[model samples]
Target chain A: MILLAPWELLLLMFANFFSRATCMTVGPRSSMGFETCYCLSWRVAVEANNAQAWRTVPAQCVLYVENYMLGGQYNKDLDVVIEQISTYLNGIVAAGDGKDAWVLDIDDTCLSNLLYYQGKRFGGDPWDPSAFKSWAQRGLCPPIPAVLRLYSRLVQGGFKVFLLTGRDEEALGVSTAENLHAWGFVGYERLILRGPAYRGQSAVGFKSSMRKQLVEEGYRIRGNVGDQWSDLQGDFIGDRIFKIPNPMYFVP
Target chain B: MILLAPWELLLLMFANFFSRATCMTVGPRSSMGFETCYCLSWRVAVEANNAQAWRTVPAQCVLYVENYMLGGQYNKDLDVVIEQISTYLNGIVAAGDGKDAWVLDIDDTCLSNLLYYQGKRFGGDPWDPSAFKSWAQRGLCPPIPAVLRLYSRLVQGGFKVFLLTGRDEEALGVSTAENLHAWGFVGYERLILRGPAYRGQSAVGFKSSMRKQLVEEGYRIRGNVGDQWSDLQGDFIGDRIFKIPNPMYFVP
Candidate 1:
């Protein structure tokens, strides 16, 4: 071994730490720092719907969740899911009878609340209904580009797209529609918000009842897409359901 | 600035590179190399049940998948899921009724096929039924420790546990039961396997029919756990569904 200057020794130590932290290792655990490895597992658990009814993001994972939401991984994950949906759409031989329909969840599926979530520490803080309502009332949430593109494709493919959300219809009906329209979420057959009939129902119950009604109305739900598991579960869930990753929160 | 020795310059260069490669940044993309990020996104999509009917793991992601399956992250992820299940089980009032039942899937859920998968490139290669059957006939797959523990807790807590699998009864019945027994999987109410009437049925169909029969027979399915979504979907899926991580293969 050769002698090194003090600065050189510090640099060498830094390199070693970095290498140990970044490189993936084949063993009982990854070489990533414990925080990173644990947070990644937590996020995967959330996306897989194994960790249910989590009220808020773990405090330690706020930054991790923030980076993931704004980082390219979130967009890339969306791309993969959209690719599958596109492939499925291409394979469908649509019935000329006009009964083919598709369901899409509004928040975080068609429109992203990233701007609102940013202020809430990416869901590190408890949910504030009034705060979220004010944010939604502004009609400023941006369209999730990939989901917007898919919506366009579905409309063009002659599939009747229904925009469904758990937002109270009496309070948010106008603003939500305007926000959606501003983002070119055009041509959807219906925008079904939570009307008085679904006042006390859970998200799963509300969405399931809506889908059941759509089925009874003679529509064949070819596919359903949502950022929450509640949107894809329950009766009449359709032929194929695509789950978009949303670790920031769980609906039920 | 002070001039440095040649070795110091080399060390500084390495430190810079490592820092750039390892540090998590708040930006459009993570600082991780493109391969690692893309493979991670792919895995997430698969786990979220968005990437459907994938024939084999992406060739480039074979090593990534191997690391994830063998690495400590897999065990930690299992721990998170098991913790949730335990919390739920502890909260049950139990009604003191013997009808309280839990359903669990076998391959890759209760028993891990990692040994065979190691030789198969961690699902880099296409599935081979004959080869897998041969491996199963050996009755050598080890128990997933976390699941084995959960099974014991469920049994001791007065919940009837059902061991369900898509494995064929005629070919794998004896070996599978022996392997489970050899690994301390005792006191299960029944070991369900694919029999003659379910020969060509898909996993969702066969498992759904069985659960429906269980319901008709007055078994209250309190919880269902499986590595595959097919095991958790369809009619009569239990009150709670726990999806265990299995990135190695897709059943349907």
Candidate 2:
């Protein structure tokens, strides 16, 4: 290698530092010069249910996850899911017996808690139950527009829509229902929330038990939609299960 | 708008064309001035099992899929899954009765067909059964390195490893075994391929039936890993199910 002058060496060092800084800020690089976005991989794992029981977004990925949540990509992703749901809905022959039913998880599926999550580091911080409960009491969660459209279609098509959630019934039931109504989630047959019966139960256990109760009630559960795997898993998990994206937190 | 000279107008038009071209090549933008990578959304949807019965990668996403598969992210993603699996394995108290089993899917999980897929536009082309069969008959597929490592650990840790695949047994039994053996997967307890009894069955049906049979044989499936959701769905899905990424193709 040719030797560089002092000034030339200083300039080269500065250039290297600038490139390294850019990589750290924009995208991370592996030692082999391969750019690897671990945050994207983590988010994909979470979506696929491969990564289970995760409590928080990785610290390093907080900004990345925040951007992904607020970015146009999240809405576009929701649109794709909605398109698929609409296509599936089009092919259904509604029995018109008023027993044909659809199941939807409320939080992050019907009503988004993005406003509360915005202050929670987009799930980078540990879960705060009381803080979240207070936020729920305020009843400010917005409707995920695509899901609302799907809900309206389901309602008009004569399919019974059931909103199932893990929210505490005693504390936030009234506010939750009002928020859902304000956001146009009306016409749903039932809004089921976690009651004393489901206290200390896992999301999978509670939701699956509730779904079993629905099936026992003679409701033919046609489709299930949720942001968490727990909401879509276990016995009586309808004929078709649709998992929406939720990189923020895992229910179990 | 201000009036412009002919040369100035030409320069402005050129700039606009350049920016538009850059956007097209780098990312497709929505009309709302938001850059959206539909391809990334599609991949995420696929991983989440939200987009089901997909035949191939989206035409526009072929390059993106190719790069993701060949680039470092794929391996990084695998590492994340393996990390989770390893952690789960660490917590298990093996019975030491030789009935504790771990199941893994073959294609894309154990033996990768990446070399063959490289010629098929990385699954952008429609699947050709005869061509795929010829490639499998050749037995040149390589082991996914990370999975092989996991396999070795499982074997050494007293877990009976089972290799399950949808390949036809009559045509590919010997070659598939040899391929797996050559790839350092020699310690697997059994290599189960699709036989005549399972012909024309869906992946979910065949795999679940086989798993049920395994359970009947007094095997306790502690963990199951596969690149397809079909491998993880249905009855007897074991205590833990791990889904490895396979954006290149969907089995069902």
TM-score of each: 0.90, 0.88
CAPRI band of model 1? acceptable
Which residue pairs clash within candidate 1? A28-B72, A29-B72
Q: Over the stretch A115-219, how does candidate 2's per-residue lDDT look in tens digits?
A: 899999999999999999999999999999999999999999999999999999999999999999998999999999999989999999999999999999999
Question: What is the TM-score of chain A, computed separately for every candidate?
Answer: 0.90, 0.87
lDDT of 2 at B206: 94
Runs in model 1 deviating more than 4 A are: A1-32, B1-32
Q: Which TM-score value belongs to model 1?
A: 0.90
> What CA RMSD would you report for each candidate?
3.8, 6.3
Q: Where is model 1 chain A poorest over a 10-residue stretch in terms of lDDT?
A: A21-30
Tens digits of per-residue lDDT, candidate 1, B78-164, equal: 888898898888789556768999999999999999999999999999999999999999999999999999999998988899998
Ten-residue region with minimum lDDT total, candidate 2 chain B: B17-26
